[model samples]
Target: MSDETMRWAPAVPAANHPGGALRRWASGWWSVVHLVLHPLALALHVTALVLLVTGTALVPVLGIGFLLLVPARLLVAAGAHLERYRLAAVLGVHVPASGPCPVTGAWWRQLVLDPRPWRRAGHLALVSTFGVIGAGVVLALAGTGLAALAAPAVSAGLGHAGEYSWPFGIPGTLHAPALLVAAAGVLLLALTPPVARAFTAVEVLTARALLGPGRGEREAVLRRRVETLTETRSRTVDSVEAERRRIERDLHDGPQQRLVSLAMQLGMAKRALDRGGPDAAREFLDAASSSASAAISDMRHVARGIHPPVLTDRGLDAAVSALAAASPVPVDVEVLLPAGGRPSPTAEAIAYFCVSEALTNTAKHARASRAVVQLWHEAAPGAGLLRLRVSDDGVGGAAPAGGSVADGGSGLRGLGDRLAAVDGWLHLDSPPGGPTVLEAAVPWTVGGDR
Candidate 1:
């Protein structure tokens, strides 16, 4: 499949809405309101957090002159997270609970030496800058409302500085100005959230600079890793299919053609003997029989190496049992899987080869009396994992030979490559003693037609 198709799969699943209670609950204006509010809450929380972080750095300067206020300074620094959480909830952001800031093992020494705390002190110095702006807007609205309500009362004292008016206060000569100021205050109050939101965005950007390892960057890195693994898996499957094609071509052209020619030659030899002496006939018959037997053995070996039919006809459970029955030593088979569902043809073949190679290694190297093969599907949190394990009661030491299994010692490298093609893994667990085990895990329904 193309990358676009793969990307679309998850979205289809996500778009499928759940039924019953969930559908009923989500089918209202409240849900829409909640959706809109959540982002606002997040912005508020992030902004407050930034302000708090900026304020924290100022503690050091104050501490230098008044070291006694260190405890109070620490409390003020911690209050940033607390206030962030509060704003998050009010805005409907799903914020997590937090305890004290994590302290490294050498926190006390680091606190004194690190530049971040000092930077935080600088941020803290600007705390009043934000506060003053926020407070100025709130107080301006309050003053205007008060002036509007008490317009008549403040008419005679219009030139006086301390006198204020409100819409519902005592009758005032300057009612018009007071009413206008109150109207302006009401408008400012209504506009505060959006203005605050924009300010918070700036604060979050600043906090990320001061706090280190911004959340967005962390999440982006994680996403990149997931994409890498997915693409790697896809490439691995493509390579495996390419290899199987190569092997099939090799067998069809080489051993298969040679066997057919040999059979034809034997047939011609028998016809010649029928026209000759009894002695000649017997010799030709014997030679032909021997040639036929050898060809049959060679063909069987090649066929088994390519793709064993037993694995396909009976699935992994029966195929493994047949393998154990064929082993030189007494072998056992234990299968623990669902009655059987067909995996992709490529996956099944790879699974069989993994088990066969493992057993072949054990029989050749490990001097064991008995062996066990187990097949099962491993159900994990998000994906279906199929596993096969081959164990032998033999000498444990088996490693890659001369760097390649083609040199004919242990088949580790070849087997590893084969497993990789089908998005599978082989793990060798052998300590230098009496028993060794090889485990294989293959992902199902990927690459080719499933």
Candidate 2:
């Protein structure tokens, strides 16, 4: 799909919304609220660290060392999680969760070896110290401004002759301009939000540096991503092989066998003709013709299952409709693709496959008499997205969430693997004793290689 179609899709960056500037400006001061707990959080973290060290030092003395070590470890882990959550809650900055240690052994051993939580625990030192400074600065700017702004009103209430009162009844040697002080107050007040925002930005950067993945962790993440991609690719290839084998089996059992019989009949017809048995030849020819036509029709059916010409020419609406038409159970199809909004071939094929597989699963396991299929194109981040949905009313819970084919449900695990190959995703909802719904979404950019 072309980029023009992207305007019709779901979700955009939240920063693009109207009143974004005002929202951003207001959000700057939110971190100041987080500073309220900084000192207490710092104290708890310190206590945990001190106990952890003490436990480690006592390890050689006896196994009694674990008494302090276990609680300390729990405290550190819980504190890190809470800290990360606070950043997200106060400033909308999310720190990625740390992965568990790969080493095998006791849980405490894993905790002791894993450095991520410790790194986060160390960040509390900065959060407490720098956070205190930030709080002081904010209070000075905002408090000073508000107190100064209120000065003029307070001064008007005080008696002043040679001893002139300053803003709040304070005796002043020199009587400064009331207007000037109020103007300074307005200036400081104006700076408060931006200054708060700057500190928030710094704190966010610090948190990300300490609490987010480090260099080794990033390399591990990249390695895992590669492994996942390789796994998905293998699954996709396996699925393709399975489908190919199914097609070959069907052809061998159906059209191929029919063609073989038709060939024998033609030979018999020729033998009858050569022997001057005209009546026998006619009967053989008629049988051969019938077999030929049946074989041709079977071939067409197999070809349609592979890749239909109608799909290539007419898009998903007509193609999926054809699938619904051929089903044993009635299927409701709703496809609302615009005339010019044809998705990329990749998207169409994946969508077609999803719809086909979902329907098959529903028919085989759902025990339902009816099903529904819906397909549409929507705008996405980089390109258009094709959305496929299949729902059936039958004995549900055939495939509970996360249930795989091994669980005697739909083979959606394979579908998920296939979708992942294209940066796409699949979702299935099959609750026991009722309706089953399957949803898949494929983006046109990477999926289509656009």
Give a tens-digit lDDT track for model 1, residues 217-331: 4576679768766765675565567667867886776667667766776777777777776666676567667766776776787777777878867777778788888888787
Residue 98 miss distance in model 2 (angstroms):
0.8
Candidate lDDT scores, in order, read 0.57, 0.77
Cα-based RMSD of the predictions, in order?
14.0, 8.2
Worst 10 residues of 2 by lDDT: 402-411
TM-score of 1: 0.48
- Residue 74 accuracy (lDDT) in model 1: 55
1-450 per-residue lDDT for model 2 (tens digits): 646466456665668878887776676667657765576677777777777778777776766677888888788777778788988778767788666565578876765676765676677667667776887888789899997887766666575533446546666532465676789899888788888777777878878888788877788999988998998889889878887898999899889999999999999999999997888799999999999999999999899878888888877788899889988879999988766667777788778878888888777778898999988777655666788889988998866655544344325666677788887888777778878888888986554442
Candidate 2 C-alpha RMSD relative to the actual structure? 8.2
Total clashing pairs in model 2: 6
